[model samples]
Target chain A: MPIKNNNNEIGDSELVDSARHGDTVAFGELIGRHSDKIYNRAFSIMRNREDALDISQEAWIKAWQRLSQFNGRSSFLTWINRITINLCLDCLRRNKRFNAESMDQIDEESGGVERQLPIETPNPTRRLERHELRERIDEALQQISHEHRTVLILHEFEGLEYKEIAEAMECSIGTVMSRLFYARRKMAVLLSGLRQEGY
Target chain B: MIDERKELKIQAYLDGELTIFGRYKVNRLLAHNAEARRLHAELNSIQELLHHNELDHPLPEDKESFRTRITHQLRVEGEGTSRVPNRIRPVLKWVAASAATALIIFAGVYSLMSPENSNQTPAHVLLGGESIEPEAANASFITFKSESAKLSVVWVDTKSSPVASPIN
Candidate 1:
């Protein structure tokens, strides 16, 4: 016997099954549940509101098409998150190609002649009020390169494993660690500068 | 990247992803190196802030439109792909051609097999009270009468000479 949809009150597995069978309502609920998360992931990576919204919608559409392939191995949101990240990565790569020579001047990897130590500056994040601290960090994140910001977001915010980040970013584990370390180093410098400037 | 190995250890330790051996080694190094300790503290503070805070600033308007737009896009895409596939067009044409040919063959066979459709008498029989020599009549013409209508029918044999021969 065919199972009834039960009025949008279904689990991810049921929604996935129905959506696979071409039920738009079931698919719509799934989108409603995870759209914000997917959008934020895109926004963090793209740093642009329009691009984030576009990537979020694109990811959901892709999820619907590949509904049959969802084997319940991971949560629906995680699967969608990976999709959003990949889209953002492709966007960055296209931009990089267009301005290839500009990124050439920046060091691709960490570890140089000096540690690039910050002079004794008070920790701005600690001293600032909570809301101020949050704003400061978001502002600092916007200043870094896409590659560095991505590793930081994946590791520090999304909390993905190094192996997972490597696979998602399509780089070596060492590169994941390297990019992450460089990203943190850059964040530290940026935050320290913010602290000194009292912003 | 101050002391690349140490920086990696700091990240691994902060993320709680280090092996037992790695954790112990980093722990020993952390107690001894001021730079490693400072770096670890800085990274840990950052992680703490991230964990406690979120980067999202979504408007209610944005949230509502996300659902509306995705639903609209899915409906449009669904209608497109569910239509007849181009890949099957050639197969459908072939099937149609085959069906037409079979229909023609069937009508031809049915006409030949039906008694009402017979226009030729047996090769040696006399017809219309004419005493035609068996060989000459067999090679020339034959006639049929529709039993239901009492109608007379005439036919000309094409295998003979071109002169028109009538069946009485």
Candidate 2:
């Protein structure tokens, strides 16, 4: 429980103070604490490990430069997560890898299978272990359209609420929900198949 | 009443967006409906898996390398303000010299035109121009006096009435 507390609670104010006074070590500590989460979010969007890593690092640099402006209205992780998400979104936009048309098309085309896929078949015993389940989820996440993957990651991975996801994604809550629904349905299908596949 | 109530509150409860009453309704429904229980369990498992997955993935290489690169970049930027390309330095120096020269010329012209120095004659006027008054002929005189030392002074007035009479 204490470990959980330590992991969840960052000494953000201390880091901010040190960083404000130009302590790179303190900034690095902050980076080390949040880097994994930031990298994962970036990876969630960019889908390329190198791109994710690059963007996440760039996001940290930007966050350090802008640390003075943080008002602590939200949690520090939330603030950093927002920056990472924005950087990833910019990278995605610049690469022209994701577009509304592609997302809409994915939803329209994939929605039927997405819905028909039984997310939870009554299981007397869960067939796939958690690790295998995770791999399936990762693969399924990759297969979904970028826009939907982003919403799902923000919601499920980052634990952001619908409103926060909408704000970060620069879309409406309705869009976030729709994307989440589609993404979850697709995930359930994919995950069920992984169970069937015995991987 | 229970079915209607559960239907009303399922999403909010599952999303952790519900108030106490809504949660109570969801709890009550979960007590009876196997489907709701299964769905909630699935959702919770999915959320947990996603959060755990974030921890599971290794830190990307770009992150480590980029941090090093960025820190080095910032240090270099801080220490080396003169890192401007060699090609541009000469051009900048030339521009700076030209600007200084232009400023000097401007200041010189401004000072010359200022009213504070209005009485100063233009250099061109002193070349060869004659005095405006007409010259008088035979208007030169010499005076000598012996006092402590013999002093002789020569005076000339061309425009005076030719010294109407000789000096006494």
- lDDT winner among the candidates? 1
Q: Candidate 1 has which clashing residue pairs, if any?
A: none
Per-residue lDDT of model 1, residues A1-199, tens digit only: 2345564567777777767777777777787777777888899888888888777778888887776667789988888888888888888777773246325424546464225665223454335667877787899899877777888898878878999888877789987888777677667777776556663
Model 2, TM vs. native: 0.60
| Per-residue lDDT value at B34 in model 1 | 83
lDDT of 2: 0.62
Question: What are the lDDT figures for the candidates, one per model?
Answer: 0.69, 0.62
lDDT of 2 by residue, A1-199 (tens): 0112342355777666666655666666677677877777787777888888788778877876677778888877888888988898777777776675465555444344544444454242445576766676788887888877887877777778888888877777766666776666566665665445543
Candidate 2 residue pairs that clash: none
Candidate 1 chain B least-lDDT 10 residues: B122-131
Provide the lDDT at A27 for model 1: 77
Docking class of 1: incorrect
The regions of model 2 sitting more than 4 angstroms off are: A1-12, A73-75, A100-113, A122-130, A194-199, B1-12, B18-51, B62-66, B79-168
